[model samples]
Target: MSKTNLPNESIETYLIRRRALMRLGAMAGLGAALPGLRAQAQAKPATPLQFVGWQYNPQIVAQNVETFEQLYDENVNYQLIPGEYAPITETMLVAGKKFDMMYSEEATLARWITAGWAQDVDSMPDVAAIKASMVPVGVRNLSLPNGKLGGLPYYAGYGSFIYNEKHLDQAKLQPPTSWAEFLEQARQLKKDKIVEFPYVSAWAHQAPSFSWSLFSIWYSEGAKVFDANFDPVFDDKFTSVLEMHRTLYRERLVSPDIFTLPQEGVPSYATGQHTFAVIHDYDQKVLNDPKLSQCAGQVRNAIMPGATRSTFSWVSMYLMGAGAADPDRAWNLLRFFGGKAKDGQYHVIKRWALQFGLGTPYTEVMNDPEVAASFKSWKDTDVALQQLQNSTPRDVGKTLWYQDWDWYMMGAVQDYIRGSQPTSALVADLHKQVGVFKARYAT
Candidate 1:
């Protein structure tokens, strides 16, 4: 098989250029050396396939791999890598470490495809049919500029507006129908001492979640972060959004540590430290899990509070390494995990949906009766599905430079939150920064 190239590059020439770049270590390392990887550059059928991912649901991952190995008479050595998944994965690839398959965010996958670290799946068996089976967003997320599928969808979900029913009830309030109402209710919650801070979000700058939270709010107000040409257009309505956040912070209506909390503050929300959040919809499962949450039964989802009632969505995927020694087997594993196994069912994807409340891009899985029943246990299915339907992936995130820009923008947002600059100045600086990135990446 030939290596894939950018749409404008010749395959032979691209390979020569990439080889020189790799030898020169032109890509900066983002992690310390990964330990315990096999030194061999290639693998045979007997060798266990190497798999790696950031820590999440390890038991389920292990069980799924075990089932696959048992059913196929194969072997896989799966390892959980800690910290900074995308950058570390890139560093490993640049250092010539081989992994058969790994988890990747959509923007991270795009960057990897452009950097020659990921193998496009255009040549996979039944690739056309597989692509057709996915939702439009899934197809868009995985499709490359060269018109090839980047990978198979691991999971896709949108940010959901979640509120604590107990908190609302205690404050004698209903779920807010609009952003203004939400602020008022939050004020009441704080005044009545039902919660010290009535809202929290995933804003930690170390991750791209700050943008995730911003997009949810911006989209709810009928704004897109980028236009059709992928230029920044968020400023049209973003001033008010920033002001709302400013009010929340200044009045202590949101968590004091909002900027530092990890991904949605699952523990904070579950333990009743906060009453509302705009994090991934799938977290409703973990938040409502009795074993994992103190406020399990009281958490619920509502349409995001804004005129448009829209939110941000994104997809993460399972990508094959460009240097996979056994392409055929790697494709098989990818299909098994991402689509259907030999059992003719979407075994792994369905398991993630039913067990962990993860979303699926496949129509069949989305409509599966079992999955629907499972969700009903933890969320209002109607509201959950409505929010999902109303969400759109942030268009700006499709760019190759998005990850870099996301980190830069997170710092800018944090500065604004800290009252270091006025909203007008912050917007001006953001626009200027966007121009700088546009010029640098020439996107």
Candidate 2:
């Protein structure tokens, strides 16, 4: 709900003018205090920069802001937008509102850039240095279709199977290597009373998460939704992907609460009740936190299992607003958050990765020997980074009509899970809808 200002006058302009007038009045009222006051007034003013992004750790945000203000003497007004950041940002941009910087994920970057809402950070002088410091996957994910950089990398996450090591050890099962193996493991765990519901699927009808869950299976089977020519290609492999989830549901291996769970699979896993979950790399941070997770320190990560070890990979980036009032200051703020500070210390992202086990796209941070030494499980982090090399070729939301496609896809998934439609019928409907979306929105 927090916004910068109305179209007539921005909050920054009004504050600057008001402060200047007040300073003049104070100087006029007390001439004797002018010498000390003059020195303070002459000091570089704090440039007010507005930033909007998904909700982050408040303590982390405060620490980053303090460090940035100390380094550059600028005030960053960070607003954490909760739930569905892309649509909220798109709406704000359509209304002609301006922000200094905003957060966008890889799936939405193409749409945001094409709509002229994002600035080309690649044009900045420091970009070459920054790019060199980042992981190659992060840089490639943030690149726009025209070969310009759409944003600066914040963090990168790859989908992986997170399991409780204790449960797996008790069941005498190694992590599953293929979809068939995964189902069998879950069934055996349930049969042996190792865990009541061994698998948790993120089936909440939402953009990105819902699509991401399906994509994990599709990608594992070496399937792609769209061809290079932008045509919808829903073959039998995709049908099998949907059927895989149906099989889990039919076997009662998946949680019934999946339909209504607001968040992703992390919550179910954290309860210490589930044996396996498909989750983002960042979820490891929460699962490892003693205060948040009952199974803390017992969770382990593996590359998602299938015919091939493939999973979804994504990056969230700090996108400079195209309509920024001060482009240099905006870029500086973005650089501070995304890269190192004036003291040559990495700022926000580094601390987050170290303290919470969140994945980082900075090679320096990941490669730091100290970082690997600090974790209870270094192999988990190492495996996730290694799997980043096998990420899906394209995010599903790259198309402009992604919202339309998402609606149809999510509904079909729900129908299949609830037994309202069979896998063959659902696949047929999905293919037909993709054709409709392609005709309407594909270029």
Candidate 3:
């Protein structure tokens, strides 16, 4: 039969023929070369695709899975792998298992894609559809080469200043408008004893949450951690910004407990212990739980203060992984989680990942007059989006690996606040540490 006149072939048949032809060509080169080539072209059992993520919440999972199953062809199956953030990713990369989908971050994605693991699904029709559904900034940060929306943002919220407004009134202070104003308010509250402790954001104990705080502060000052080549900048704060943090601490205007405080310390500020806090906008959950926090009505979520600039971040930007068994499946997950599918069922995982959390990305869903009206304390998702949109990406300098850096930095800040370290000493130590970090992670 003429090649042009070949009979209609099923999709499966086409893949088979293509594989066979590829094998024949490889065999014509070398017998050994053909073995690896054959494996690449081979198909594995069509089982349910697996996704391991830290952002998993049961309700969100149900929402996403239901939509996926509905839209998924009979060939695909959905499986969720339960794991926390950093540990889960580290485990996956180290073990080399066959996870069909990996929630990717843009920084790490560059490394993974460079390793030839990412499957190119740019041709998929849904790719375009998904991008169409997202807001502009989401499209920019989460997309391929920083353009194509590769992974659906299962859910996202922006970093901002979440403060205790009740204490502000007690301190006879107005809400802050700038970084200077923020510090002024905190100082007044501390002096008036409206709060026994200074503003304590025990950021490091909560790594992602710490990133939120750092990114917010850095962006507020027009600092960026990533250059074109992913340079991590540890010392790029706007004039004396780091010094200011140290000054606030050394002056005993901020909390000393933040140095070794438990993970829940900073967040618990909404409970009325501390007068002010800086955190992501989506985490107003502290204010809603009337049982946990005393500052329920007193808690306010608003824009991050700006010095040279204002900024924000999601827990993460979903990027494509480096090595995936089924690149297409991985892309499918990205598309779905990133909010590409039109079906309402698609947000199940997004909802589940956030089943019991805050700062969702579905602007429409989170902003539904009903959703906002239902939860009086539900912080506005718009605040985060607007903050991020108004500002630039944070200052990581040469790398995105700040897990250790934040822990150390926040500790340093706490010590200074407790009068354990002098501001000058803290700055000097941090400057040295910044250099060490740049050497260890940036280059």
> In what order do the candidates fall by lDDT, top score first?
1, 2, 3
Tens-place lDDT per residue, model 2, 30-63, is 2122222223333455446777665445335646
Quote each prediction's TM-score.
0.85, 0.84, 0.71
Greater lDDT among 2 and 3 belongs to 2
lDDT for each candidate structure = 0.75, 0.71, 0.52
Per-residue C-alpha lDDT of model 1 across residues 157-242, encoded as one tens digit per residue: 88899999988888878889899999998898888988888888777775546778888899998877678777777565777888
Sequence-dependent TM-score of model 3: 0.71
In model 2, pairs of residues that clash are none
Give the poorly placed runs of model 3, Cα more than 4 Å off: 1-46, 58-67, 70-84, 105-107, 119-121, 144-148, 225-239, 264-267, 315-331, 340-345, 349-357, 360-377, 380-385, 395-443
The reply for model 2, stretches above 4 Å from the true place, is: 1-47, 376-379, 439-443
> Which should have the higher TM-score, number 1 or number 3?
1
Across 281-378, the per-residue lDDT of candidate 3 in tens digits comes to 54466444554454566666677667654766543545555555566666666666655454554454334333334444455655556555544445
Candidate 1 matches the true fold with a TM-score of 0.85
lDDT measured at residue 153 in model 3 versus the true structure, 0 to 100: 66
TM-score of 2: 0.84
